[model samples]
Target: MTIGSNSPTRQGQLSVLLAVCLAALILPLSFSGAAMATHTIGQELGGTAAAMNWITNSFMLTFGGFLMTAGALSDVFGRKRIFISGVVLFALASLGLSVAPSLGILNGLRAVQGLAAAAALAGGSAALAQEFEGHARTRAFSMIGTTFGVGLAFGPILSGFLIESFGWRSIFLSGTLVGSLSLLIAIPRMTESKNPDAAGFDWFGAATFTAMLSLLTFALIEGPANGWTSAYVLTLLFGAAAALIGFVALENRVRQPLLDLSLFRYARFVGVQVLPIATTYSYVVLLILLPLRFVGIEGYDEIEAGLLMLALSAPMLVVPLLAATLARRIAAGMLAGTGLLIAAAGLFYLSRIEIGADTMALVPPLLLIGIGAGMPWGLMDGLSVTLVPKEQAGMATGIFNTTKVAGEGITLAMVNAILAAFAASALQQAISGKFNGDEIGAAARHLATGDLARAAHLLPGISPETLAATYGTAFDALIYVLIAITLLAAAVVFGLLDNAKPSEEEANPVVSPGE
Candidate 1:
């Protein structure tokens, strides 16, 4: 059932590669809807800000924790078998989520969905890496990147429409259709790629690694919410540190470790691995903040806001295809580094937005951000695995995926905390100011609707105008902080990375069973 480099079945293998990549897109679609739904529902359910945070954080924790294990299993067993299994599990979980009766049940199902997604994601990348080589492989990776950009750009808009038309439940049900299609394509087309000589599964290593990752993510996400110095936070943080040390020690001694620590010795691998975390950190901050600002503050409906936010993703859809062509001609490191700079510039432009800013005002900044984000999104995976030995491709890909998810999870939580703190501070200042209380209240009401009624009740005193000014200033402050973060990310890229082409010695390292 294995595919040979020059086998007559290569065309069939390519079809399977396409199916696997498309299936990977489904998870993001489902997830984008679920994340937004949870936030909206949490607001309705009287859940505090922290509860809203967990809706996405929980899924990310499970997704990031299992990636290494999934990649290890793909290398040990077979990518096709694991991918099919994952699609089935993912569909079932979506069904469970569609019928979930409570937030607790829904959250549990989301965690399961993340686990299944990790399996599919890891297996799909491994399959592509195994199925093609050289220029063909580059094209395949580029297309995969394009799908990712399209998914990110389209997921929120599609989800918003579903939620608006049929409620949040429809979002999960829609996933069932996608999962079914991917499974149908997968069964006949995908061929197994198992290393028959690979060592047995490293159950101990997997378990320890998952435990360590889960604890670390949990601490990072929950710490600020609970007060970073709280006893519970401290305990989780210390436990995470200890588990990580233990996991590293176990990997060093294992016959088939989940992660090959030696991969870090390659500069390209390290650069690609860390670059996504920083870039995604900046990207997710915009993803979370913009929609809230547009819909919550600007008086736009969910659907309208979703459409407006498309500005950020539109270039993402187109730029990756262009980047794929560029990667073939230029140094991948230079492309990645240049992409980070472009994104940083976009983030800085977004920092200029004011309280009453129009969608038109956001369009230019978003276009820049989109292009910047898309370029590296296209190349990170290729850069990561290409720098490692062929035998260790699965491990390298898994690490790359893990870092990206970890970045998204930690950044989402941190950005939310920052925005909440700023908004609350602004609201408090508005409330405490000396003014005709009735007049100030009226002004607040008018601003909420994004309108200025002619009625006398709509008019506000000088203090109310000051309050309005304060809110705008607060939002601007947060944007500045985000801009600084993006800049720092770009600096990290330029400082830490080298501009060398990937080498054959690094790409085909020695195989030790699961190596």
Candidate 2:
């Protein structure tokens, strides 16, 4: 089960190992930038604001919903087989997306790509887990986390370049190439790892769980736009609740379930799942808000905004490795808690940003946030997997991913709601002073749509200088809300987490002696 050990030349196998990890890295990059690109392209193609939301939400819905099922399938089938299938599916989806004639087709393809991604992600981690053991496993997890950090951090900048150089379609075309290459590499070199004694595939549990997650995710993403009180939203909410209740009942009755509902009984497992969700929520919110704050309010263009975002991503590349090394000496919980505190401090600093604030002013806080965020993200997966038995690894990993994705989905909706609320209140106050409420509201709406020029026109009777200052005030209010969320997450990490050290057995479980 060790990587590179059987090869005549260990270095050759190591190369293949690295390539496999790179393949894992490229999957996330394909869709991580979709949020920004979708926002931009949706507006250009005469799509409404809601379309922009769907561009991101659709992918997340499918990706998150299928993750548990995909992981379980890998455990029942074979990791290499699932990995290759996912790569092929992703490649074809990317090809279709590149030339899609309409938003509907593009969004559909993106959802397919997301499903493919879930397969690849689930299989990749399982492959790595089986390929390496003990300390080597720890390093493998760290490497995978580092790859994810780098991909996500650089995805926006890479997307900006592709959009500027070739066009929005080029982003998908590039993904096709990466996916195709990953498949080619994986098929020949990747080894199979399936539990021969694994229980029969839980088809019923998988179907019900997928339905439950899809319904829940749809409600979370759509509720804000449709008005939480709307009949459509209420129906979705009720449907999700019913589906989830049914799923729980089904799991409890099934012989082999996709999710082990009993895992939450362990305090450490609970912390492992909850911590990632909070951290990822904070990460995604910053990813969305920072670009808007920079390009929309501070008047930086796409390229400039991308460059500024690099400040947040750059530290992600290095900090995870540092955290992994630190984990050998310190407890994972301590590292995670410290990282959260550092990220909170960074968010507090970012909240003080002004409309015309110097771009360089943000560099320090962005670095701190990136470094801090990278640490826990790097270590959490390994920590989470170690908390359960070897046979339950796939199920436990699925639960971990589901929580993180749910956190991400809920956070996106909640943060947007907070921003809208704050912006509306600020607009009302500004109108009472002298500004036109309708104009400011129109401007805010336009700004949200990625059309700054139209937004500018909505400001009346104010000098250019004064208008800039007013917009800065509104932006500051939104940042304050983000600051609050980050602080809350930090508090949870510190107060709830048990700062216990992971045992060797906990870190790497042995197969049962009888087995």
Instruction: Please write out the lDDT profile of model 1 over residues 248-277, one tens digit for every residue.
Output: 898899887777788666554566676777
How high is the CA lDDT of each candidate model?
Answer: 0.69, 0.69
How many Å off is the CA of 320 in candidate 2? 0.7
Which residues of candidate 1, in runs, are more than 4 Å off? 1-7, 43-46, 424-475, 495-498, 501-515
Off by over 4 Å in 2: 1-16, 432-446, 453-475, 495-497, 501-515
lDDT, residue 384, candidate 1: 68
* All candidates: CA RMSD (Å): 5.7, 3.7
Residue-wise lDDT of candidate 2 within 230-322, one digit each (tens)?
Answer: 899889888878888888898898878888777656556666776777676546667766665565556675667778888888777888888
What local lDDT score does residue 271 receive in model 2, on the 0 to 100 scale?
A: 67
